[model samples]
Target: MPENIVIIGTSGAIGSAFTRRMSALHPASKIHAFSQSSTPTSEGNITYHPICYADEASIQDAASLAAETGPLDTVIVATGLLHEGDIRPEKSLKDLSAKKFMKIFEANTITPSLLAKHFIPKLNRDNKATFAAISARVGSISDNRLGGWYAYRASKAALNMILKNAALETARRNKNAVIIGLHPGTVDTDLSKPFQANVPSGKLFTPDFAATKMLKVLDSLSPQHSGKIFAWDGQEISP
Candidate 1:
C-alpha cells in the first residue's frame, strides 16, 4: 500500500477530489495535499503544503517535507492552465501570442516535469509505484481534428513528451515505477466551465466521477504501462 501519496494542485477541483478519494480508500496512508492557492484545511490523514512550481525552491521544500512522512508511492500532478485573466486559448494563429504561449508551457509542461525531478527518488522501488500528471486528450497529435486552442494543445503535447522520456529513464532505475499521463476528459470544473456549454449530454463529468475513473486507472497500472497516456475509461490515447 502507498504510505505516502502526494497530490499537487490540491486547490483545483480534480486535485481536491483525488485527495479525498485517496484519503477514503487508504485511510492509513499519508496524503500530502500541495497547492499554491488553497488555504490549509484540517482533513484527517491529509497534510497540506504551500507550493508553487514556478519556483524550484518551493517544490524542493515540499518534497523534503513529504519525504519526512516516509517513502512516497503515488504522486499526482493535477495542475493545469486553461485560461486566466486576459489570457484565453487562441482560436486561431492570429490570436496566439508569445506571452500566452510561455504561460501555458510554464504551467502545463514545466510543472509536472519539475515535480517528477523532486519526487522520483522517493518512489517505492520495491513495490509498484505510479507518478501521473493530468494531460489533455487534445495533446494527441494524431487525434486532433478541430484544430483550435493551439497553445493549450501544443503545451500538453510537449508535456506528454517529457513524461514519456521520464518514464523510460524511470524504468531503467526503478523497474516497478509507472510514470504516465492521464486525460481526465471534460470535467465540470472552473477550467472547463468557460468552454463547456457545447459539451454533449452526459459527457461532462463531475470532479468526483472523473477522480474515481482516474483512480481506477491508477489502481490497475503496471510499470509496463509507463510512457503512455490513458483516458478516463482506461483506454490508451496515442501520442
Candidate 2:
C-alpha cells in the first residue's frame, strides 16, 4: 500500500517543494499539506489544509482531519522563522524585548512541539514511520561559536530537545517509529534572503534542492536513527 504523509508549513518554499517531490515519487500516497497562509494550489496527488502553527486549536483540528484519511506514515514539519529586514530590531541581551523572544519561541519551537504532541500519536504502529521536523544548525548548543540571534538559536535548541525527548517516549510504545530533527542548511527563501550575504556561493541551496535532500535523509532513516540531528547533506549533527 502507498504511504500516507502529512506535511506542515506547506506554503513556505521548502514545504511546497517537498510536496511536489512527494507527489512525483509516491503518486498513490495520500499527501496532506498544511500551511498558515493562502491555501496551496493543489496538484494531482496533494491535498491542502489551512493551518495556523501558533494556535493549538488549529493544530488539533488539522490532526483530526488527517487521521480521518488513514494512519500516517510520515509527518514532515517545514515551519521556521528568521527575523527579516527591520521587522525585528537587533539588540544585545540587555536591550532585547521579551515579546520578540516569545514570538521567536512560538514560531520556531512551541509550534513544532505541539505538532509532535498531536500528530505522532496518529501514526500506525503496524508500519514503520518517520516524523521529521525542520530545525537549524544554530540550535546546537555545542556548535554555537558565534553568539547572536539569541532568540532564534534558543528556540531551535528547545525544539531539538523536545524532539529528542519525544523520540525516547515514542520508542517505548512504537519502537518502529523514527523521530528526527533535520537542518536544511541555508536555502534560498524569504526567511533566509536577508541573511544570505555571508553564506558562501554554491553552499547556499535552493528550496527544491534542500527539500529533495531532506526527503532523501528521511527516506534513509530507521528507528535506530531516532532522536538524531541530521543536516541536509546526510551528515549527523551534534545535539
Candidate 3:
C-alpha cells in the first residue's frame, strides 16, 4: 500500500470518495488532498489544501507542501472538465469553437500535465510509485464510434499522450514509477449528470464504487503497466 498519497481535485465527488476510501483502508498513510476550495479542518490521516488548477505556481506550491512530509508514493489527479455554464460537449462539427476547445483542453489536458510536471519528480525512487489522471474511454480513438464530443474526446486523447510521455520520462529517473490514465466509467457526478439519461441500466457508477474499483486497479499495477489506460473493470483501453 502507498504510504504517502496525494490527490488533486479533492472537491469533486470522485476525488472526495477516493480520499475517504484511502483514509479508511490505509489508516497509517498520509493523504494530502488538494482542491480549489479553501482548506477544511483535517481529520485522521487526511489533510486538505487549496489549489488553483489553472495556475502552474499553485500546482508547484501544493507539490512542495506535500513533498515536505516524504517522497510521494502515489499522486492521483482527479481533475477534469466536461460541461459548465455556456460550455457543453459539442453535438456536431458546427458546434466547435476555439473558445470551447481551449477551455476543455485547459482543464482536461493542461491541468494533468502541470500536475505531472510538479509531482512526478517527488515520487519515491526506492519503491513502487504511481501517478494517475482521470481519463475517459471515449478518449480512445479506436473505440470512438460516435464522434460527437469533439473537444472532450480530443482533450482526453491529448491527456493520454501526456501520460505516455510522463511515464517514459519518469522511467529514466525511477524505474519503479508508473504513470497511467484511469477511466472511471461514467460515474454519477455533476460532470455526467446531464448526460446520464442515455446511460444503460446499471452502467452508471456511484462515486464510492468508482473509487473502490479504481483503487483495486491501482493496487494491481506495476511499472510495466505505465503509459496505458485502464477501465474500472481492470481492462486496458487502446490508445
Candidate 4:
C-alpha cells in the first residue's frame, strides 16, 4: 500500500471526495492535500496546503514540502476546467476564440503538466508509484462522435500526450512509476453541471461513487498500464 500521498486541487467537489476516500482506504498513509484557495482544516492522516496553479514556484514548493518526509507513493491531480464565468464550451468553429482557448488550455493542460513536472521526481524510486491527472473521455480522438467543445477537447488531448511523455521519461528513472489519465464519466459536480441535462438516466455519478471506482482502478494498474487513459469503470480509453 502507498505510504505517502499527495492530492492537488482538494477544494473542488471531486478533489475533496478523492481526499476523503483515499484517507479512509489508506488510513496509515500520510495525505498532503493542496487547494488553490480554501485551506481545509487538517485532520487525522490528512493535511492541507495552499497552492497556486498559475505559479510554478508555488507548485515546486508544495512538492518539496510534501516529499520532505519521504518519496511520494501516489500523486493525483484532480483539477480541471470546463466552464466558468464568461467561458463556456464552444459549439462550433465560429464560437472559438484565442482568449478562450488560452484560458482552457492553461487550466486543463498547463497546470497538470506543472504538477507532474514538480511531483513526478518526488515519487518513490524503489516501489510502485502513480501520478494521475483527471482527463475527459472527450479527449480521446477516436472516441469523439460529437464535434463540439473544441478547446476543452484539444486541451485534454494535449494533456494526455504530456502524460505519455512523462510515463516514458519516468520509466527510465523508476521502472515502477505509472503516469496516466482518468475519465470520471459525468460526475455530479459543478464541472459537469451545465451539460447534465442531456446525460442519460443513471449516467450521472456522485462524487463519492466516482472516487471509489477510480481508487479501485488506480490500485489495479501496473507499470504496463502507464501512458494510457482509464475510465472509472476501468476500461481503457483509446487515443
Residue 211, candidate 4: C-alpha displacement in angstroms: 0.5
Cα lDDT tens digits for candidate 1, 1-239: 88889999998999999999999999999899999985666579998878978899899888888889777899999999999998898888899999999999999998888998998878888999889999999999999999989989999999999999999998988998999999999999999999899899999999999999999999999999999999999999999
lDDT of each residue in 38-157, candidate 2, tens digit only: 475566878898988768999999998888988888899998777843445344676477877888888888999999999999887888888899998999999988787888888889
Each candidate's TM vs. the true structure? 0.97, 0.94, 0.98, 0.98
**Residue clash pairs of candidate 2:** none
The root-mean-square deviation over C-alpha atoms between each candidate and the true structure, in angstroms, is 1.0, 1.7, 0.8, 0.9
Candidate 2 is scored at a TM of 0.94
Pairs in clash, predicted candidate 3 = none
For 211-233, candidate 3 gives per-residue lDDT tens digits of 99999999999999999999998
Which stretches of model 3 miss by more than 4 angstroms?
none
Q: Is candidate 1 or candidate 2 better by lDDT?
A: 1
Q: Which TM-score value belongs to model 3?
A: 0.98
Ranking by lDDT: 4, 3, 1, 2
Better of 2 and 3 by lDDT: 3
